[model samples]
Target: MSSIPELLAVTNLNELSINDFIALLLTVADKTDLHPALKEGLPEYFSGGEKLREMAGNLRQLRDAAATGNREAKAEKMAAWEAGKLAVAMNAQHLTMLSLHRKDPSLLNNIGLELKQRQQGGKSSVNVLAETPVVTAKHVQGPSGPVSGSIVVVISRAKNTIPFEMQMTDDPSNESSWSSQGIHQKSRIEYQELEPAKRLYFRVRYHIDGKTSQWSPTANIIVL
Candidate 1:
């Protein structure tokens, strides 16, 4: 019988002789260091490490069978390989998220925002709502009367801290022209009595702790 190390050195699939398979099996068995009773329970072909060697021979036979154009065997091996790769990728992603969260606790919040955006059809799931842009004659009467139009916007956040002062802008260059609104934990906003017949643009600004985030994408509302 060839030594365990000799078996591990056999790299050529085409040259996998019976002795080579047995050697490979011995290598695997030696590495596992199974209990004596468990080792004894194995068939004579595997006794003292022969069992593993036989298994290696069987594996080579399967491989040869696959090479001989057994589509099913080839597919099975391919599926196993893909599954192993997927498992590795999932593990990598989990580790990455753990590391990122440790470095920046706010990463979870960002991930939540991404998930919400996906759920909301790829456009920003966050919205801002309001009544009509037209300052209808009825709305001019005051806040007490029924508002003819209302606007509502929704924003998504993973964290408990809500954004401060969501805003709207007609143009990106005119920062001072932006209008402000209060953000709620529910990620929604309502603006009543918007002026009629105007082209209005809206954006959201949020802060975590004291650090402020950039504005959300601007949405345009045309009030009749």
Candidate 2:
């Protein structure tokens, strides 16, 4: 049996056939209990495959439509392509979780919990700008009445100076509405005076040197 990392690399290459992909998915799903690494990564791992399959289906449809030069079909295919890209991203995240699980099972619970909270907290809905590196707020606490505490953003890449832009958001989809911080140095972003009982959303976009990096999964902070 291929090791999980090997399988992940294969998936990354997009070389696996549909049947092979499905088989791997089934293997991961069925044998998660046996592999401690997989077990630890289960939450993220399991969530990825269906999305991959959906993306594959979309690509197939798009290819066919393109060959036929059907305008309406092309438009639909483009939409599917966009959705598929998101699905592939979710799968990539699962792969990252798996990698972390192999390094330390103890982190599995913590990482899983973080991922779950982010999903619940509305960060997952944000558009990921790139795969180079990502920063996300793990937790935020403010004063009892009207003070925003420190904002923590997790960086996925090797530690380095990653420039980021962050601004408050109410509409997650309105990326433009988010004010940019203008290439600040650091992975985590912070703001103050965000009052209690108010819901604050933030859109963060970051880059290294010139290449674009992953944006923070849209994060919401509620002061209490």
Candidate 3:
């Protein structure tokens, strides 16, 4: 754990393997500028949020180079990405922590984070592990008053769990149809911009001390 609540205490790059979590960190950092109360006390880490988005862009470039066999750029892009991915994620987290201290911690929900979390030095769970994670969720409202089409996914976590992945698919029959929502550090994640009135399927899997769990059973919800 970090000595200061404002500091993010991640020790390894793998802790931020999911670009979604990086994305989540960005959502909080960038939105602070719009939060009337928080805009006045923005933390320096939000600057890291800008850098994180750039890192994500580089990651996509690396993927493109790898996919198209653009050998000339792969090494260059990969090296730069490796040099900054963890810093970007951790810095965003660190800055958000400081911002939270200046405002209501409840803002965590507004930013898609659950207030209760454990991976960061909280008490460890001792129950025997399930073979796969079980996912549950509720839809969130839009800013104006109607349904927002956002899904807040929740999962039970064990002490061994490090981070988890969330994915969605409309065609469950096709193995190749699944689209990833990216990696998230916490179990309670929000799914955004889903098509209305369509059946959406979701699943989760966890990474432990370098091992991965089997994918969870499908959990489906009909968008409002």
Candidate 4:
């Protein structure tokens, strides 16, 4: 049995291995006092039997791809694995929030908000918690080489006063380290500065009532 501290030590989901995620699933499964929502959803997301094995198999394939230097295969597996991990982590967070509120119903909304903020710490799972903004950009020939056309970002969640951030990167693989153009309150914007033949990657994040969403999937445009 791993100590609570050891499991809780996972500050970043990106740093967690497949095995660690499996162990977390097992831990959650063993808890008898889970909230009704978690109890119902646990089997689909984190069953100690078949679902666990399937995830392990996926991780194995990912490992094999990495060993063989298959970048595309590795990337696909990585994205799938990341998506699964986020789904599971989201459940765990919900369970934590449920547990806290069970002790005192007055702590419901505020605790939920706090747990949400903690979940967003990874940024990868921000979209899971908040609305994922769809972003698009286009590059066109201009007076000076090439320039980006309209950059539009949109999200239609139930919440209001959504904030957003636009980010750009030169390489698709380096989207994790993209530079932010700055935060914006609107869903659409246009800025035209691009170099010819250069491929630009773009993504956007929306904020729901001060909570930042996970960055949207990346969109790219090649300068003419």
By TM-score, the better pick of 2 and 3 is: 3
**For candidate 4, lDDT tens digit of each residue in 1-224?**
84222112123556655434433333333332333344355544444334534654566556556657789877877786776566556544544555565664332222112334454355644544555767776543459754444333343433445555566778657423455455455655655544566777787766432244566888886665
Model 1 over residues 1-224: C-alpha lDDT tens digits? 94212111112322433322233333334432443233334333223334334444454455545666799877764554343333323322432354354674333233111222233232222332211111111122236754445555555554435543355655656653554343334555666767766666776545322123455566666544
**Which run of 10 residues does model 1 get worst, by summed lDDT?**
129-138
Ordered from best to worst TM-score, the candidate numbers read 3, 4, 2, 1
How far residue 108's Cα lies from its native spot in candidate 3, in Å, is: 33
Taken over the whole model, the C-alpha lDDT of each candidate is 0.40, 0.44, 0.56, 0.50
TM-score of each: 0.31, 0.33, 0.41, 0.37
Candidate 2 Cα deviation (angstroms), residue 14 = 32
Task: Return the TM-score for candidate 4, rounded to 2 decimals.
Answer: 0.37
Clash count, predicted structure 4: 2
The backbone clash count of each candidate, in order, is 22, 1, 0, 2
lDDT of 3 by residue, 9-103 (tens): 23444454434433444444444344454445446544433555566556655654654668867687567655565454554475456566767
Which portions of model 2 show Cα errors greater than 4 Å? 1-132, 138-156
C-alpha lDDT (0 to 100) for residue 33 of candidate 4: 32
Please give, for residues 160-193, the per-residue lDDT of candidate 2 as tens digits. Answer: 5544444455555743334333445565555554
lDDT of 2 at 202: 56
